[model samples]
Target: MEKKADQVSVWCIVSMASIPLVMTLGNSMLIPVLPILEDKVGISSFQSSMIITSYSVAAIFLIPVAGYLSDRFGRKKVILPSLILALIGGLIAGFASWKMDDPFTMIIIGRVIQGIGAAGAMPIVLPLVGDLYQDDEEKASSCLGIIETSNTFGKVLSPILGSIFAAFLWFLPFFSISALSLISIVLIFFFVKVPKEKDEPVKFKEFFNNTKKVFKAEGKWLYTVFLNGVLVMLILFSMLFFLSENLEKVHDIKGIKKGFVLAIPLLLLCTASFISGRKIKGDIKTIRLVMLSCLAVMSIAVAFVGFTNKKIILLLAVTSIVGIAIGALLPALDAIITENIEKELRGTVTSFYSSARFIGVAAGPPIMSIVMKNFLNGSYIVAGVLGVILLFIVFKFIKENEIGNQTEKA
Candidate 1:
């Protein structure tokens, strides 16, 4: 009944972890290689940005649908097909990049397809993780933390992997998506054994009504979590984008050097997530404190960044602090959302949360590109203010409850 690491094969956790990592690498691994695409395809920079945006945009709209379907049919049912679809999209993009004279359009098309598949992939994994250790909050929180870490780790690895893959052939990163997805698909299929649901799938009308009731009961806390998810992701990606640009433009750092420099904050984030996940362990009080503290720290660090000049070392130092805060916040937020929600509702709610995250990803670069370029230090100031706003929301709205004692029904 208690699906601890020993009871549930560590391989199962690894399989689940692969979903987020591959999902991340699938999209992000293209960032550093975008310039190469621009050179090879003769596309403008804005057009190049669209290549990345298309995938996220596609995922954003479909994620809730995917979540609902997963809840109805099963997570594995949704995830396997989605992984296959994502792999297909990667191959399409890879082939077009390899063989086409004018590959930009096809590449975009492929990315959109991949995005559609992604809507069902990583988003679904959250609920599945929740399902795994349903009777064991400590393990569940730890597993969710691992999932979040894998996702952040992918962000840290993306630029480096993109550059390395591009060194062999510009199209290799596109193909890499397929390779990564295939790995996830195989691992998931063989190792991730989801527990069977005893209840018959609810009809759509009943399902919709139950979802509404859930919001009615938990809307305040849930909304705050969703907002925080969006805000943190938006700020994180925006900061990374800003850093990547300045690393090359201002510091004259480029290529692998730029990737390593860009990775510092992300590595901080990844480490923070792992440690926070271990510490929280489904303690409701600890979760709330972690959220509040992380948000407070993030706000202060970002405000400091706003005041500081664009000196590379100072910027990295402040941003790395922000990264750690964000990294810590993620697991706390995730554990709360996952542990408190009813099992039947977990898939859909987490889907919405994942969609909020994708919204941030979709908007971050373009938003930061405009804000940082024109508004100067205004970007950090805005983010700092938003972080403060989240701090207030979390403190005011997140009620103290014994999450481990939550009643489970499916």
Candidate 2:
């Protein structure tokens, strides 16, 4: 029987939710501060973006490995050490910003370490949520939605916090991440408990063979879902970067005002995720419909962002629509992928999906920096075109039964 949200362990929910909240704070918190970092740290536009990219680049490579290790060793063992690594990274960056004459490179290195920690923590939370609920599909879906909402919630908070911190000291955002990570570490260590399972560890050779078999059987729809994830994230982050830079460069809106403006879309996104997660509830048809509809909204809204430069309100209206689209898209992707994969391989499979998403994250800032520098409108054009393409791919390939069968099994 399905359980209500309140019936789930409160501590498990809190601990699970904290993982994404902290991860988002670690990364998205830097968005509003990127422009300031360029001047304070003596870096170019592209170099400043690398502070974000360095973390994602490391995460994109290590995430799958972390997933596999989690499946082998259990989730908490991997998670605790990962939290420590993230704390260490934050400390390194915070110290460099305080003491070093040339701290930019050191900060980037610290971000890379933070990314490694991220690989183990946030991505694992999906499967860990799946593991927590076992056969309780209703609770899993609800909890997954809440977890995703937490991720978006962090985004909602990051810009405002980053702006506030950077206003005082340019490096305060980095230090704040350390404090946040420390809190998550304590919560997870004390509050989160992974339910035990009796499955034996598969040998690497057998594991590869099974993964390959699963891919060969499911790669078409799986690849489409993976690509869709990449496209959505790429568009979202790239546009955020563009918006952040433009607010400062064009509108002279900096500090807290800019942070509030950035938060507008993210707030909408966060609300959408919370509502979508509750409404979707493991239904396959709902997943496809919501994803497609959201992509359509995103495409048109992004295109509009390109055309309207003079009116901040117009930009806010369009970008808010883009936020809603992204907000809905994420939880749907998580539900579909989680439902489709087997329990034993869920971590590994989702890790690869997370890695694909991180590739978009890693690429977004640099691409935005380059495109915005050469032609400001080009970033929106790219976002719109990619959305259209991904929408088409999903419409054609992602089958209802593929999702239905998985949901039925759950």
Candidate 3:
């Protein structure tokens, strides 16, 4: 019985690790090819941006509901269906890119479907990890950290992979993403084993009542921190999107050179994530310090990007600093949420976190694009202001609760 239990635990951890890989690979693989799609599909810059926004819009709205369903039904049930949907969306996008007369619109539609499916998969995975670990907060946190690292790894490799695929054919990246989604589906179905809920199903009224009770619980501060973390992610992505556009349009950088330039900050981010994963051993204060410091530095970087014409060296330095901060912060934030929330309510809270992130992801690009294009005083001013605001929120509102308390330690 002991050996069997150990084996089950190992399998659960492996299954949990797979979730982030799927999510990260699907998204990251598309970044390098955005420029290509714009040219190939004959879309405006703003319309090209919709490829990202459409997916995020769907994810923002759908993740909370998906989280609730996962809690009510089971993680495996939700995840399996999500995989199928994602696969279908990927195939549609690929086929559209391959044959459709209006490729961009079809691609966006397919991405929206993919986002809807991802809503069910990505957020629930962390909660599933929490469910699997039950009492082991440390292990659960470590698992979440590893999952985050996998995500970063995917991001790190995505540009190179996307470039290679795009070199072969504009539509190949979509097909590659589809293949990965299908593989993920098979892996989860065969390997993951979520335990069925022992409690009887609660009615809708009772569900809301329970959720309200949970919200009113003393440790709501964690939710605030998580939300702020999501904001930080938005700001980071906004900066990246703006930078990418500026590099291509203003600086005349394109193709693989653009990919390489964009990759610099991600390398720093990858390093920071790795170091944080090794050192962040349940110290909430330490985690907060790292996160806030990164945001502060990121603010400075944004300011720098606005004024500098040196372009290559200056942008690289500032973005590298910002990337490091983001890398250290994300896993810490995720672990905090996963470790602090109660098991029964984990899905709901994680879903909320996902929603916040999706909101940021959806809003970041267009908001930055508007600020950069219309607000002539220099767009970096807007980015800098956002960074400063985020820093203030993190310092003033995000409290570091006691680490071991799972009930209300937000």
Evaluated with TM-score, which candidate comes out highest? 2
Give the TM-score of each candidate.
0.94, 0.96, 0.90
- Supply the global lDDT for candidate 2: 0.87
lDDT of 1 at 189: 94
Q: In candidate 1, what are the lDDT values of residues 1-410, reduced to their tens digit?
A: 45445536889999999999999999888877776787899986567777878899999999999999999999999999999989999999999999999999999999999999899999998889888788888989989999999998998898888878888898999999999999999999999888877889999999999898787767788888999999888888777766766777677877777777778888899999999988899888899999999999998898776455368889899999999999999999889989888788899999999999889888887776666666857778878898888889888887686233323221
408 in model 1: Cα distance from truth in Å? Answer: 12
Q: Candidate 3: misplaced stretches above 4 Å?
A: 1-14, 218-220, 250-252, 374-378, 400-410
Backbone collision tally, model 2? 0
Better of 1 and 2 by TM-score: 2
Candidate 3 versus the native: TM-score? 0.90
Candidate 1 segments exceeding 4 Å error: 2-7, 304-309, 402-410
Per-residue lDDT of model 3, residues 92-116, tens digit only: 8999999988887789889999898
Q: How displaced is residue 80 in candidate 2, in Å?
A: 1.0
Tell me the tens digit of each residue's lDDT in model 2 across 1-410.
Answer: 23333334688698889999999999999999998889988889899889989999999999999999988888889999998899999999999989999998899999999999999999999988887776767667788899999999999998999999998999999888889899999999887767756777888888888777778777878898899878888888888888899899889999999999999999999999999998888887888899899988888789878777668889889889999999988998898888778877889999999999999999999998887866768768777888898889889887787643533322
lDDT of each: 0.86, 0.87, 0.74
Question: Candidate 3, 215: how far from true, in Å?
Answer: 2.0
Worst 10 residues of 2 by lDDT: 401-410
The local lDDT score (0 to 100) that residue 350 gets in candidate 3 is: 82
RMSD after Cα superposition, model 3 = 2.8
Tell me, by lDDT, which candidate is best. Answer: 2
